[model samples]
Target: MRVLAFLDGTLADPDAAHIRVDDLGLMRGDGVFETILVTDGRPRELGPHLDRLARSAKMLDLPEPDRAAWERAVRAVLDNWSGGAELALKLVLTRGIDGDPEQRPTGFALGMEIGAAVLRGRAEGVAAITLDRGIDPGLAERAPWLLLGAKSLSYGINMAAIREAVRRGADDVVFTASDGSVLEGPTSTVILLRGRTILTPPEHIGILPGTTQAGVFRGAEKAGFATKVEPLRVDDLLTGDGLFLASSVRKLTRVRSLDGTALPAATEAHAELSAAYEAEYA
Candidate 1:
């Protein structure tokens, strides 16, 4: 696959890379970024994705990205990509190298086009184990200086949780607070179905406020499902009709099991919700 990297103001092949290590993002993981799926050479929800990226950057105290420049770079990468179907574009803006490690560094934008391999397409929806620390409701309302819902480069803990789930023979991990209130997945958003209502955790619960998940809910409401963002518990899944993990790439994958227990088969509501979500991006 041919890949292009836009570093600072120059766009070139990654192998011709001259990325500097002094950049905090290169050495210390100090930056914010966004990944988007591209279909038929057009980005899905381009405006919304850029909005989220800007919000995350502001939360991190980083300079806002140039939205127009980013879009042009994305289009350029796609133009060079021979395989245009179901591709992915990543917009990564990092704090550039500082003259001194103790000083704050200016930021630079990087764009890359890569192929996506979606395991969820062929595999059954994932089952997950709950985390002990449920996300605090208060944190979602007020941004903490460091954890203000920013898509920071520091995601070691999140990745570790997902690895733990894989070790237990599950596809992913679902985090909940000690109180048993569901939070979200390692890299995807959680959505549950109960009868006619579609449930997602409120953003005020410190959830990532997933882009794809929100899109799915919007499509669901249009398709006649009563969608809501509310607190959900692990017990809800054990007793609910079905559950799903939503993401830009994964789109929607039904959860067939939870904590080793098999979820009830998909109902009419689940089918309708899934169809609505899939059809929107299809």
Candidate 2:
């Protein structure tokens, strides 16, 4: 079952929650969203998620989201959703109808059951492929209007890349820059294991700052692994000891292979990644 709540205090019937057809968010993808992991009735890293939401809004020039209101709506959905199983809590904020200045922005919170594939892939690992993003991230810095670092709803390209990954016989993708520098996965952050250090690309290169990776890096430190945020390239993954992906809903999932070639299996490190992901608060 799904539990949904509107910022306007609407709850119970999801069908009743609706946005206008002319809403800029639906028409032009003028919106931002966050996918959160909810274990039982508790949300993981809610503060970080909200802060990112605000940052995305500021990037889009949308009004700052009312965080307290969003938190309450999240609670209401969790209360409505009854179960001990993990759930994906999606918070969506959109620009309201065009020319309707009086109308507040459209926003809602949705709590839904996690899919079997995402949950199973966590423990079993997944296959991935690398695709060039075809744009220099340095261009992203100069072209600030591209909104590169924000988690906006303009995800048509990202979804298309995933379809390409499936066609290539892989479960996910790791996007590289135009120069073949490692960036991140479509919906996850890329991590590489080298000796006792965990390395990832810095977020300043036009990629979204991963909230899950932040906590996981901390947990990895506690688990006796040093974590570093730096620049990486395709060669690094090809020669690394192991590779993994981390996301809020997916937590941490090891990459069993990339580009159809099997990677070196690091079962022990995979377990540590899982344990570290679990150590993140709910």
Instruction: Report the C-alpha displacement of residue 179, candidate 2, in angstroms.
Output: 0.7
RMSD for all candidates, in order, please: 2.9, 1.4
TM-score of each: 0.88, 0.96
| Model 1 agreement with the true structure over 1-282: per-residue lDDT tens digits | 554645334457666655676777878777877778777766777788888888887877777777777777676676666764666667776777756655444433333444233554324556777766545667666657746366778788888887887898887777886678888887788888888787988876676778988888888988888888888889987888788888777777777777899887675555677688767777
The list of candidate 1 runs beyond 4 A from truth reads 7-10, 100-117, 121-123, 133-135, 267-271
Q: How close to the true structure is residue 7 of candidate 2, measured as C-alpha lDDT?
A: 79
What's the C-alpha lDDT at position 238 in model 2? 80
Each model's lDDT comes to 0.72, 0.88
- After superposition, which runs of candidate 2 have C-alpha atoms over 4 Å from their true positions? none
